[model samples]
Target chain A: MKRSERLVDMTKYLMERPHTLISLPFFAQRYDAAKSSISEDLAILKHTLATNQDGILETVAGAAGGVRYIPYIGKGHAEEYLGDLASRIEDPNRILPGGFVYLSDVLSNSQDLQWIGRLIATRYAYSDIDVVMTVETKGISLAQSVARYLNVPFVTARKRSKVTEGATVSVNYISSSLDRVAKMELPTRALKKNSNVLVVDDFMKGGGTLTGMEELAREFDSTVAGICVLCEADFDKEKLVEDYLSLVKISKIDTQKRIILAEPGNFLTETDFSQL
Target chain B: MKRSERLVDMTKYLMERPHTLISLPFFAQRYDAAKSSISEDLAILKHTLATNQDGILETVAGAAGGVRYIPYIGKGHAEEYLGDLASRIEDPNRILPGGFVYLSDVLSNSQDLQWIGRLIATRYAYSDIDVVMTVETKGISLAQSVARYLNVPFVTARKRSKVTEGATVSVNYISSSLDRVAKMELPTRALKKNSNVLVVDDFMKGGGTLTGMEELAREFDSTVAGICVLCEADFDKEKLVEDYLSLVKISKIDTQKRIILAEPGNFLTETDFSQL
Candidate 1:
């Protein structure tokens, strides 16, 4: 293949498999090009990605080494996306009954999920997240997107037990939204022992669900690498979890007045984008 | 930017936004290059994608000319992937108490979902689908994956209504597994009226859930563009829905004997790859 054709295919291949290593010899064999030429093609890919601040092509040295694409968005891009997302969240029509904000529209959007997933994956690019975990229904999309960028599997925890899952391990936690104790469970074979879990969700009211996921990770003898949510209800002052990050923070929601106040959360400040 | 850098960026950009048209002038402005140069770069991308039979770079001519990246996998790739997937599903250890095969592992796998998504999107690349819909729980991931590739929004039909969703439109269908009448609902604002909906799910015994989704789509005054499931239970011998495709068909499962059988379904034979 010619250099131009190789570059196009190489970019598509690397982008599809983020955080995966591709050795120089393998690329050379695939393209029928010399190792030196493959290296030069990768240099162009690496430089273009860095110039765009959308990804990173890390080159590992030695025989077992290769190039790995990391979905890393720069600070400026992150700030701009989050700012626009927050503004979109400020729409008064989104305020629902009992102070709940209707965010299913944003959650269902593929473009929004792509940006959100890349942002979250960028935060834990080097955190060694073995698997991404989320609760049923709302959190599934968020977890799936993040897992896609991280190139890892994602498991969803369900509230009700179903016969299809075979054996499962259950956990009980306070459901602050319903003001009751709620039970959730995961399939026994869904997650492996001692795996590093990244817990994600669509919304956090009092963070009761986040705590439940943390407890479930403990039951599997796994470590909670991080906790993230797409939206956090900051008006609910009493939070059940402390160590968590949110993309957008809802500071106030007046259902009667039909007003909502939102802003980019602490995720931007908590992340270090300088590692690249 | 140089031609090499432009090719890299253009490939990444078009891949990210699949099924969306991008004009030559837009690329020209983004890369600060001439329209002719951008056309040449796209030609390289189009040729590479066609040679690989993985994607289609559709060109729309006249005054509103542009390029669209359709995530289309050829018959050969589809056959190879579904064959491997079926073989994996043949593991006897996957059989559960009631003859239900454990598929959470495959469903949670990012790599598998990526392939599955591309395959399904390839089938519906030109179907003019407005949105993807699926029943909640297991189908959420499948629906989300297809939605990502099609670059459209996806909505989940919940078995039970949640407070987060204000109002819902529900339908009743017979749950063939439990042999009881069951209800499923979708939020009123989740889907738009007159949409061309594609219903997808993880498993289909009698396709009761898929029927409910189709009925729900009808309630929204939408058309059912397609119906697809990751796995369908062929041994059941009876189905509530007929117009659907399955990636893998489970022919039999003997719990006592610890044996199971699976194969690729009608999806391969039903699709026309020559459309490209």
Candidate 2:
């Protein structure tokens, strides 16, 4: 193939498989080009991605080395996106009964998920995460999106067991929203032992669900690489867990007055974009 | 930017926003290149995608001219993937109590979702779908995957209402798996009226869940563009719904004998790849 054609295919290929290595010889064989020419094509791809500040093409040296695409969003892009997202969350229409904010619209948006997924993946690009974990229903989309960018499988823990999942491991945690103890479980075979897991969710209130996930990870002898939520209710005085991140923080919500206040969360400060 | 760099960026940009039209001038301005140069770059992208039979760069001409990236998979690729997927489903270890097949592993796989999403997107690339809808729990990931490729938002219909969703519109259907009447609901504001919705799910026995989703779509005054499931239990004698597509068909599962049988469904024969 010609250089131009190769560049287009190469970009698509690398973007689809983020955090995956592609050796130079493999590219040369696929394109029927010389190794030096393949290197040149990769250089153009690397430079183009850098110029756009959307991704990074890391080159590993030596015989077993190759180029790996990292879905790294620039700090400016992150700030702008989060700012817009926070403002969107500020709309009073989002305030629901009992101080709950309706975020189904934003959570369902593909474009929003793409940006959020890339932002979270960028933060853990080098975290060597083995898998992504989230609870059922609302958290599934967030987990899937982050897993896509990280190029890893995601496991969803369910509140109830189904026959389709076979045997499972269950955990109980306080449901702050309902002020009751809630039970959740995961398929026994869904996650492997000693795996590094990244826990994600759509919303966080008392962080009880996150604590439950941490406990579940312990049952499997796994490590919690990180915990992140798309939104956090900052006004909730009590929390069951610490050492977590949130993309947007909801500081206040007046149910009677229909008022809401939101801003970008600690994710902006906690993530080191400079690592790219 | 040079044509080589432009090609890489253009490919990435178009792939990111599938089914959305981008005008020639938009790319020209983004890359600081001439209109003619941008056209040449799009042509190269179109050719490369076509040669690979993975995507379609559709050109719309006239005063409002632009290009759209359709995530279309060739028949060969579809056959290969579904064949392999069916073979994987044939493992006796996947069989659980009551003849239920364990598919959480496959469903949680990111690479598998990518292929499944692209395949489903290919089938509905030109179906003018306004939104993708599925029930809560397992189907959320499938819905999100197809929604991402279709460039549309996906709404999950919950089996039980939650305070976070606010007002909900519900429907009652007979759950064939449990042989009992069941109810499912979607938030009132989650779906728009008169939308063309594509219904998807992880598995189908009597397709009761899919029927409920169709009814829920009807409640919103939306039309059902199509219905698809990742797997269908063909051994089940009766079905509540028809006019649907399945990627894999499970013919039999003998728990005592430790045997299972599976094969690709009607999707391969039903989808018209010639449109690309």
Each prediction's TM-score against the native? 0.99, 0.99
Instruction: Please provide, for model 1 over B1-276, each residue's C-alpha lDDT reduced to its tens digit, 9 standing for 90 to 100.
Output: 999999999999999999999998999999999998888888999999999989999999977989999999999999999999999999998999987889998888889999999999999999999999998888888999999999999999999989888899999998888889999999999999999999999999988888899899999999999999999999995899988999999999998989999999989899988865
> Docking category for candidate 1?
high
Candidate 2 clash pair list = none
Model 1 per-residue lDDT tens digits across residues A99-194? 888999888899999999999999999999999999988989899999999999999999999899889999999999989999999999999999
Two-chain complex of model 1, DockQ on C-alpha atoms against the true structure:
0.89
> DockQ of all candidates, in order?
0.89, 0.91
Candidate 2 has a DockQ of: 0.91
| Per-model TM-score of chain B | 0.99, 0.99
Off by over 4 Å in 1: none
**Which window of ten consecutive residues has the lowest lDDT sum in model 2 chain B?**
B267-276
Error of 2 at A212 (Å): 0.4
- Show how many residue pairs clash in every candidate, following the order shown: 0, 0
Among residues 3 or more apart in sequence or in different chains, the pairs in candidate 1 whose N, CA or C atoms overlap within 3 Å are none
lDDT of 2 by residue, A17-110 (tens): 9999999999999999999999999999989988888999999999999999999999999999999999999999888888888999988999
